[model samples]
Target: MTLEQARAALAAARRVAVLTGAGVSAESGIPTFRNAQTGHWARFRPEDLASPEAYRRDPKMVWEWYAGRYRNVTHAQPNEGHHLLAWLERDKGDGFFLATQNVDGLHARAGSERLVELHGNLSTARCEACGTVAPLPEPNTFTPPPTCPVCGARMRPNIVWFGEFLPELALEAATRAFEKADVALIVGTSGQVYPAAGLALETRRAGGVVIEVNPDETELTPYMSYSVRDVASRGLAALMGEG
Candidate 1:
């Protein structure tokens, strides 16, 4: 499809679904977890700090790692890419749905409410006993392993560790949106990770317009209706007719 066709699809479509990934976060200066590691953390692999087995082995260590990450994200500012999606959400309202592989909470800070964190986020703690999720304490005052306010049980970082399923409700909502969308915007993803990839495929199967925005062609590039070869901020700006 031509660039005009891509823009027309976005402008005319009533229901839109968006999927975002690490490249979006990177634009805001938030490094991927592996890349964020430094000093003592640099020695460990991602699985060492992010797996259920690792948390079970030493919950403190895992929580501490996440605590550092929480601090990192809180210190960073949301970029134009984040704000544009949030603005798009305002225009689309209930017709919009956003699902992100990122866990930094930048989208939330940028004013997106109709969204889900596919991989969970670092801004909160989940009650191990009661399942209540609560925001973490202020960065400077927080210590590792916050306790649950609801149950007084030990609260773990509100993250989906390896070997865990994405929250069922979140996954189902994102899937439904993709399946029914008229346009699906996939931004900054490698397209290697499933079910994020699966969402794009769902859009394809439903005969929806699938637009991918990335600097390089991705695994799903072959399936896209069109691709914008640029970074998230520029690509999304172009899509919104603001570039």
Candidate 2:
């Protein structure tokens, strides 16, 4: 009944918004931030590599850590969940808005264009001086601490660090979309993370239906119009299947 209800709402709705989390990318074998720390990396805390202070202390170490992660995502292929969202964007066209907390860039690889990566992507780097965003050198040729071509300044992984806030433009656009959406899908997130997690509420507050798709119940489950109980691919398949 829950799945049917969500399917009905989505089928009829033209303005749709979606928010994806780490679980979507994890389905493709990309480990979570903590899960990536193994072997030699097991000794360091997350704050040591992901915070601005950590970068200031040792930019080399920080870039090394990110470089490994970049390789991991670069090698990964988009899964069924990613393809589903991308297909959804093609259907909705101007009415679709997809936002993701995951920085793996799988959504983009899956062909989702009208999307916002709430966090930064690992496939690219941002210059420290000119703030120019550019793709990383090819995986084999890449080295840590890349320099900018525009201003000749040091480049850092284009990621949102622990102490830093999300990019204002992305957040604002997502908020606007969520507020105006006719249906909002919150997929594969624990809802423990703030601001991004709060996006579902924006849908409900604006009289839009909010649906959750996850294998387990999250904090946001109780408030949703319906919650599909499964992982991202299977859960989304159930919601969208045969409809």
Weakest lDDT window of 10 consecutive positions for candidate 2: 1-10
The residue-by-residue lDDT of candidate 2 on 1-243, one tens digit each, is 367777999988999999999889989999999999998899999999999999999999999999999989889999999999888888889999999999999999999999998889999999999899999998899988899979989999999999899999999999999999999999999899867567999999999999998889899988899998889999888877774
Query: Which pairs clash in model 2?
Result: none
Off by over 4 Å in 2: none
TM-score of candidate 2 versus the correct structure, residues matched by position:
0.98
lDDT of 1 at 60: 92
Q: Estimate each model's TM-score.
A: 0.98, 0.98
What RMSD does each model have against the real structure? 0.9, 1.0
lDDT of each prediction vs. the true structure? 0.93, 0.91
Q: Once model 1 is optimally superposed onto the true structure by TM-score, how far is the C-alpha of residue 210 displaced, in angstroms?
A: 0.1
